[model samples]
Target chain A: MEPAEVEFLAEKEPVTVIPNFSLDKIYLIGGDLGPFNPGLPMEVPLWLAVNLKQRQKCRIVPPEWMDVEKLEEIREQERREDTFTPMPSPHYMELTKLLLNHASDNIPKADEIRTLVKDIWDTRLAKLRLSADRFVREQETYAKLDNLTLMEINTTAAFFTESLNHMYKLRTNLQPSEGAESQEY
Target chain B: MADELELFEQGSDAGSDEVLLTPAELIHQLEEAWLNEKFAPDLLESKSEIVECVIEQLSHMEENLQRAKKGDLKVSIHRMEIDRIRYVLSSYLRSRLLKIEKFFPHVVEKEKLRAKEDPSALSPEEFAFAKEYLENTEMFLKNVTLKHMPPNLQSIDLLKSVPQPNLDSFVFLRVKERQENILIEPETDEQREYTVDLEEGSQHLIRYKTIAPLVTSGAVQLI
Candidate 1:
């Protein structure tokens, strides 16, 4: 399976496209795309919207979730929750990054969105670091890391491996040296 | 030519080469090789050679460690370097092995269909290495099952169950050219053809498998 981040952005997240000219339906591998009419709003995959926007054939309408006030509320709720609060989309971070990078001009309050996203990311990362510290200190073998994003996973994977290796070394020191005995024999 | 001859001579002499590559150089080489393989997997004809060199250096480091452990030498700083090199080498190989395993079925099918010796995507050494790895892993699993697990599980083909890597992986990439009329088969739909316009700096999140050939041909690049 693809990471939830990639899967959500690629498949589920929708972008509103306002085409500059009328067009008949175009067949795609996923499905038929549109009967694009000039100045009328039509929803399409983010990928297609970006492509069309790049070609100067359409202007993209940013999703409602990009709102700074909405994200702030969500961040507060997330901070209060003992478990991970359900996000608007699994790929919220990646989507925000992509849209901000590609279609900033289309989005309202793009700068605010960028700052809010960064704030949310930083808060979530602080929480993740806390959990990681507890995990290492407690020497837990298994963890149910609900709501951990792919980016988060990538960041912590090396740390987890190093901690595990340290634990293994400690365990080995507690036992008789197998290599030493084998070499002697 | 002289440097190449010296390297060959050093390799032949094995332990006699006192001035082997510094740990930093070895680490740099490993990272470079990894990046090279990642970007242009098909161009990795020298991967096995690099792996061999790293292994030899690793063994030499191990020997030094053994001597140090017995108070016969003083090289404690090398310990961290050795561990770092080992980790990098293992990861580099593991990434390559994962790719090889994921594409093994595709490679075999393509070879049979085309009736060719070279599978365009993977080097001959890489293919053989992957095949051997699969066999060894299967044997190891069987041994574990026989020793610890119930006999009922013995019939299961564990090797076959190793899921292919990045089958559904999506990548953010930019099209470098006006690739026209490309055919793509989505996971849940029939094949469809579309013309992609390459207005410079256009990016999309596409299935890596769909654009892998394009990536290899430098028509697109992962961002």
Candidate 2:
């Protein structure tokens, strides 16, 4: 993929950074990164923030969506809506996993964030199971999923494939004689 | 040849006993293979036999098509199914080839630099196919970086600098074995050796790069 595409994926995924030292604006190929001030939080791409955090140059402020209360609200909204609710980022799961893994100490209430993320994931997956059941019952070839993160899509796709295979097996067993004849041919 | 035929027959018995795989079955197998490759890239070596079998079946189907068109045989096969199988097979192979190309960028670069002197560095089959994949990827990378990116960033080598999102990134994993004397770098710049003695069910957030060997060995799994 192009750098622009990569940047587009990263653009909306903001991580808060608290630099230890003051610095003038640092230029990057895509754009200027910062005119960083000591002890002040600034939002930057997850990648840049993680890089700086790994180097002990900055501490990461978890994204707003990482808040437990906010996630609970979003989860409720998702449950109520017949359609997928708007997500903060298409790559939210991945970004959250990356940030939490790399900068858990830097985050406020890290354990709470982790629990909430897990709770939300479990709820979403339960809903996905329901939808997948319906999809298989109806023998739908495609589904339009809304508000699903990339990780959820991967999980759902695997489930869908399994369901499809099961249905194919059922269809085969329903006509044992025809199946035998077809096999001979 | 008889053993190969018997294997094909057994696969056919699961669906229809046609000389070649039905489109649905082919697609299903392809999807399974794709997923297997995605989750366990090392298992790809084992899958080569399956891929070869599919290719052989496809050639047999092609010959059947020719005979049916000449009115010398009566075979029942959908043209659209053949087309679909071809499309899926090519796409599956292409995606895997791209990943292989990306994973070994240094090797690919070296092969390019020494193309004339050591054209046989890659196996004959790999050299023929990977040469094209490498060239296409190179051109795509160049266009993206040199033209689409800002002039200052044109010289930035993306593959070398950019962290691969899924591959080199941090992952939450559950330990499955009592690993000893493993070295890891934490948030601090110091490298530490820790015996990963976490209870079997305990999970930790680790850089996938640090635990890749363990992952392959089934000592840890991405959770």
Candidate 3:
């Protein structure tokens, strides 16, 4: 999957926005969205929030997990664990990038949050690579990857799966008779 | 009122499979189908009903928006939503077309072999497209390349020449339904096969062949 597509999914996530202008409730196909009152915080999708922010009509309230201290704790937990750690949000990385890139002024200490997210991402990716290597070395057919997020998986899914397919092809060729049917792609 | 709405929905293909999903649920299904089609190695069963409903919904909303005053915030937001849905819908259809082009012969063969009662893997339009594509490719080969070959080599078996989908290819999936005692096939001789219970909401890396049925059944989602 494209990184942009991952970001697209992240855009569906709801974020609180304080609209500066009041408006009536609008009926949308997916659902309805607020009868806005000035200064009242209302929940809208991240895409709408970003657009409203761009138009200077609202202020984006950063998601609670975007805090500097909480992320540091998650980063520590990630480094200390041998297995994948659960993320605050499944699209945490993509959400952080989107919010910071488009509405940085709305978020406090954007630089620190950005650096912290990168650290957690790097740590998770390194762990993912190590486990992938072990999985290949062991010739294992199944792996439980409960804590891994879509963006992290997408980064390695194509390359990892192709190499495994090649390895499977080579292994079956050596045996010749047993797995003959599956050998052909 | 609810009964009347349900009766109205029953007139369309959308009501045939399952209960009527709200417009929101229809959008969500389209996105899910988009991602599934994007990741799976082969063409999946067609979602033409959902596709049609979404298009209808979008056009209906679009016509309503047209009469509204310009520069309205609601109008713009609706337009953005429309564009987003259009993107996913087109991407889903485009990926199916790409797979159709790559494995046209096999796809056509499968369509032929399917029982009359089963839902077609290709929608009516797609089936026509595939047939036309197959015919055009064969004609191009015969006219441009095959005619020049020796008499015995004149014919080409597309089913043999074209590669089949690697059904055994590894795919990443998230289980939506808890399944007990699913067997795992070992990659090599040394490892013994074992069964694992797929707990709901857990993710796994496994062979596509093992979970293809699960994918079709909507018990697991290909990530």
Model number with the top DockQ: 3
Worst 10 residues of 1 chain A by lDDT: A176-185
Best by TM-score: 3
Q: What TM value does model 3 have?
A: 0.94
The DockQ scores of all candidates, in the order shown, are 0.02, 0.01, 0.53
What is the model-wide C-alpha lDDT for candidate 2? Answer: 0.55
lDDT tens digits, residue span B69-148, model 1: 55221233245345556766776676666666655544444434653443234446666776676567557666765457
* Model 3 DockQ class: medium
**Model 3: residues >4 Å from true position, as ranges?**
A174-185, B1-18
- For all candidates, the clash counts are 0, 2, 0
Predict model 3's lDDT versus the native. Answer: 0.88
Q: How far is candidate 3 from the true structure (C-alpha RMSD, Å)?
A: 3.5
* lDDT per residue as tens, model 3, B1-223: 0111111222223235445677887788788889889889989999887888888888888899999999888899989999999999999999999999988999999999998867688999999999999999999888988899999989977777777788889999999899998899987788799999999999999998898878887888988
**Model 3 chain A — which ten-residue stretch has the worst lDDT?**
A176-185
Cα misplacement distance, residue A182 of candidate 3 (Å): 18
